[model samples]
Target: MDLDRFTRQSETEWRVAPFGKMRVPAVIYATEDLIRDMDDKVFEQITNVAMLRGIQKAAFAMPDAHWGYGFPIGGVAAFDPDEGGVISAGGVGFDISCGMRSLHTGLTPDAIERHKSELADALYRSVPAGLGSTGKIHLDPLEMDAMLEGGARWAIERGYGRAEDLERIEEGGRMAGAEPGNVSDKAKKRQRKEMGTLGSGNHYLEVQRVTRILDQTSAAGFGLHEGDTLITIHCGSRGLGHQIGTEFLKKMAIAAAESGIELPDRELACAPINSPIGVLYLGAMRAAINCALANRQIITHLVRAAFARIFPDARLDLLYDVSHNTCKLEEHWLDGARKKLFVHRKGATRAFGPGHPELPESLRPIGQPVLIGGSMGTASYVLVGTSEGMGLAFGSACHGAGRRMSRHKAYKTWMGRQVIDELAQRGILIRSPSSRGVAEEAPGAYKEVSGVVDATDEAGLARKVARLEPVICIKG
Candidate 1:
């Protein structure tokens, strides 16, 4: 937090020179105030990340960086497999592939306002949310494995979403190399009935209106316009992700020593890139990524159905869907030669730039959409990736406002009913099954999202296209 601790590299870049066990330097992109308010543990965790084996470049943190288990929540680090790189379960939190998805509904804010209350109630009723929520759709063993392997493509084949929607999602909505056999039976059981459910803790479905457009060219490319009503889904691979993370974190811890990894912290449990434990974890993790993609695809169908019941003419189209908390194998030209590295982005969004082969043809000229979700009752933003970003932090950007306070601290300071009532007075509708959960997600507990986005844009991580203000929220 103390600017004195780091050397200024540029307006939005700060460098922490490596000392003591660090193998690389640490870089953070944030304004002074955000860094000042950040917990000191972020510095320690990021420094720890620099000490990992086979680290390429510097360990980096985005503007929304915060204290987290093992690596900082907004951490970014890449390792070369050829250099004996390792994968850490702690790098990917409990909620594997947890990310945000935005939908473009062919409607205006005025049209939505005409029946806002009814629409809110309909969405809340149709979308299963909150803790331990289950859906009507269930999956058997064979079907479960199929979904894991097929991802959103499987959901589309089952008539959940349109076939064209796959192009808007990362990895064509189905990550390759996903082996369902690597997923444990216990994890599958937990997700059997949670196919279309929104798990609790920072997850929600919101109806938003584009309040502003920062870049007209990019906004038009993204099919976003002022006052357009958008539906945003924020969730992940329900119980399955948590189960995989839980099971593997323990295995990785025991396997670390055998893999000859000298971890500075036990929480950063890891295994060599080629180790059996690492291979199995990757397989299971990729499958979990598919589960998250399929889950969102099904939820998109549910949203369309709910809206269709109220306004049959309303058309909800996929904008883009990307996952955080992943270790993706990508090639980047480092020092002169192109090298394949495993880039771990925990609580950070991938902002692939224009002309990148990974992007869809329609979006190749513009860039990938980096959805930055705001806290409850706040305004989220849509930013486009920039070529400059690919050189910084490996095309990574801040995912959200990031928590300013702990959940326990938030609950002790505010009551859920009171927070809900205040937001309602501002014309924002809030619905959740648990008041305690609501209190834990109070908007005041987070940093100002606008500032984080500003820092991100200033740092060249992404370019802001439009801003979305929440009109209704289905909380989990």
Candidate 2:
């Protein structure tokens, strides 16, 4: 976190010149205050990522960067397969495809305020949350493999959501190249009953109200209006993703050793992209991505059902769904040529700029909606990806108001009951199975979200669109 360690390129950009086995320079995008508050480990981890073989451009950290396993959370790096590129399970984190999905309620905050409590209770009962949470749908072995391969498309086929929803999801709601055979039996078992459930730790389903429109053009494009209500789901692949990461990290470590790939840190265990182990990991990882997409799709169905019980006219339309975790093969302009690379984004969102072929036609003019979630009782923002961001860090932006304190420290500092009461006073209802979980996810435990968003915008990563405040939150 020492300012002297980096050369300031601008107020929102800092660079660490390549040194000590580094294949490229390291960059961090954050305001001075944000950077100063970051843990020193962020510097070390990002620099270590730069040392990895086949790393292109720089290992970059977002404004919300924080200490994490192997690469820093909010880290962005790309590797070239033809140049001995490697895939690190650690770079993707345990929560594969952990992401955000927002839905339009077509109702104003004033309209929902009267029934907020009833709506909150209905959603809490309908959507399972917290540790080891399970949903009504249970997948058998065969069905599980089908879900792994089909993703949200499978969920829709099973009557979970509408087909139109896929257009708003990344990869058309189904990540291709998923080899379910590579996913272990144990991992599938852990997720069998977990589909549609919000797993513990930083995951939640919130009813938010749009309070500010930062960019009128973008807000209109995203169908946002001040006072409009929105439901945002923040969760991931549940136990299955964690199981895959745990199983593969150890295997990758052995593979890294066997392949004689020198690692700057043991946690940075990786294998060449073309290696047998890497192929297996990628297959399993893609399956996990599908698992997450399917899970969210099911949750969306449950949310709509819950809303039906409260407001029969509510139309919970999908706005956008994007994942922050995963190593994806993407095409980017490198050295004036379009090249294919594997981009790893851990706690970072892909902010595709305007006119990208991958984006939905309706949204292409404005750009991808970069949904940034804040801790419970805090304000979240909607931003649009900038064309300039493509060249900056492979079109990536911060995932959220990154954690500033560990869960242990947070729990020790505040009682869950007290935190709940405080949020209640602010009119932000908190519903969770565990009081301890509430304490662990206190809003104060994270960096100021507005500051992080400002830095991201200033750095040309993403442009702010709308800001949302929580009306109710069902936490996990």
Q: Estimate each model's TM-score.
A: 0.99, 0.99
lDDT of 1 at 27: 96
User: Whole-model Cα lDDT per candidate?
Assistant: 0.93, 0.95
Q: Candidate 2's residue-wise lDDT over 1-476, tens digit each?
A: 79999999999999999999999999999999999999999999999999999999999999999999999999999999999999999999999999999999999777788998899899999999987667999999999999999999999999999999999999999999999999999999898889999988899999999999999999999999999999999999998999999999999998788878899999999988998998999999999999999999999999999999888998899999999999999999999999999999999999999999999898999999999999999999999999999999999999999887898999999999999999999999999999989999999998789999999999999999999999999998
Q: Across residues 84-149, which tens digit of lDDT does each residue of candidate 1 receive?
A: 898888898888899999999888777898999999999999999987789988999999999999
Where model 1 places Cα greater than 4 Å from the true spot, the runs are none
Among residues 3 or more apart in sequence or in different chains, the pairs in candidate 2 whose N, CA or C atoms overlap within 3 Å are none
For model 1, the run of ten residues with the poorest summed lDDT: 253-262
